[model samples]
Target: MILLKKVLLAFFGLCAGGVIAAGVYAFLAIIGVFVRLMGKTGTRKHIFLYETVIILGGVIGNIMDIYEFPIAIGGFTGHLLLGICGLSVGIFVGCLVMSLAETLKALPTISRRIHLAVGLQYLILALAAGKMTGSLLYFWQKMASLG
Candidate 1:
């Protein structure tokens, strides 16, 4: 029965992650437009990093949910706590990316890059982040289940 519940929870959590990612994408789309309109192109490089962080957070939350962290603790409050931690991690990732991006800005050839390349760059970042986080989660679950 517990195994079944965990499976169901994992399924639901994955679904929720997709929903959250979509919602964040929509929100980011709006913010991107707003920023561009406001002539804030200077911050354009950071936008993709923020999006990557949000996607990573949602995915990490989904994985954490597979272990039923919220129920193990209390309930909604535990979920909130987990969510906050995920978000804090995400923000940290974004800050790191932002800092690295700033350093790259000094490259004379960076301006020659095509617009479409930015999309690819973020896509790669998201994929890499998700892959690493999922693998970490898998190992964590394995170790946890052994105990």
Candidate 2:
């Protein structure tokens, strides 16, 4: 029956979505994002709030992204909001990358293999600068091409 097929499809889709969500949450937990924040802040009192915001933000962000929602906050306030969002996203991504590298011991292994000593901090700074430069160049080229 047509109704039965639709129901089955919908059920499978929901199950798949649930599985993906669980995997994403597990990844975040394994990366210790929340734990890092708690450790840096020296407070666990707002852990619930932090967790709630992360969950809601993920859901709302996905919904907005999928639906192509237009957030029409124009002018200076909009620019400020955009800047804040950009900085937050950049920081989150930097933290995620560093944590993943640490988990894999990639940087340490590389440094050791290269016999790098007394310049690890400079190497990190150089890597960060290179990433920033590359990101800016990529976006610049994309914008130029668009225009």
Candidate 3:
């Protein structure tokens, strides 16, 4: 009975993880991240390579996170590596955000749906500003907590 329970738990865990990964990838695809990236860089020929990198990156990231892998890098090399990682993450996030914003066109659509014709531009500007402010506040709080 104990062995059966363990098998069932492992099976369910694997299934759940697969589903979550699929959902995440699907969302990324739907948001046009890959399409936008390739178009911008004229890397249509290298789409397969781009996709493989994304998949491998996800797997390695998950493994490192789940296994709590520790980095032993120190000094200037460590800071340089950290900076590169940060820049890569920032670029990815910016691309993702732009993809989402372009794909959704949410503010304009909402304005049209609600017949809010007059201040639609202001509404979009306000939404963007609000997002920036919220992001700044959240990061500020996170930095405070860390220090």
Candidate 4:
């Protein structure tokens, strides 16, 4: 019985990990495509609008996951809250970076450098958000196992 439970937990963990990874990848890919599309127009307003939507989406997704899943496991609530907080911070930072980059456009070279940095920062944040969601799923599974 114990072995079976361990096996099930392991299986679920992998599933959760895969789900998170895939979701994050898809989200990033979509954002990248949107940014590229906006870049074609070469307008600061469009870029800002795109960034706003992406940040809003990220926040909404995290909130949805927290509400959708059962948060009965140890530390699950705290983790979820922290994840939400982190997502908010990330969004703010991403927007700030983008705004700064837009302002630096006159110095073409600096703008490119800032854009890369901002992109990387957002990627890291998105990955972290995905990881938190995965952890929440794993915790849910473990809690379910107890019953």
Candidate numbers, best TM-score first, in rank order: 2, 3, 1, 4
Give the TM-scores of the predictions, in the order they appear: 0.30, 0.77, 0.70, 0.27
Evaluation by lDDT, superior candidate among 1 and 2: 2
Mind giving the per-residue lDDT tens digits that candidate 1 earns over 64-113? 76566655655557656766766666655554544445445632345355
The residue ranges of model 3 lying beyond 4 angstroms of the native Cα positions read: 1-3, 106-147
Residue 129 local lDDT, model 1: 87
lDDT of 2 by residue, 1-147 (tens): 999999999899768877898798789789887788788888788889988988898788767866898889876677568668876897788878887787778988989999997798799889989988887777658646745
The per-candidate count of clashes, in order, stands at: 0, 0, 0, 0
Residue 131 CA displacement from its true place in model 2, Å: 0.8
Q: For each candidate in the order shown, give its overall lDDT on alpha carbons.
A: 0.61, 0.81, 0.82, 0.63
Q: Candidate 4's residue-wise lDDT over 1-147, tens digit each?
A: 999999999899767866885696475554454554456667657767776777687666766765696646446676568568666666555544444454555335643656764466565567667966886687668656854
- RMSDs, each prediction? 16.4, 2.9, 4.6, 17.5
User: Over the full model, what C-alpha lDDT does candidate 4 score relative to the true structure?
Assistant: 0.63
Highest TM-score: give the candidate number: 2
- Per-residue lDDT of candidate 3, residues 1-147 (tens digit): 999999999899878887998899999999999899999999999988998999999888878877898899876687568667865886798779868977888657787799997987687678667876776677658656755
Candidate 3 global TM-score:
0.70
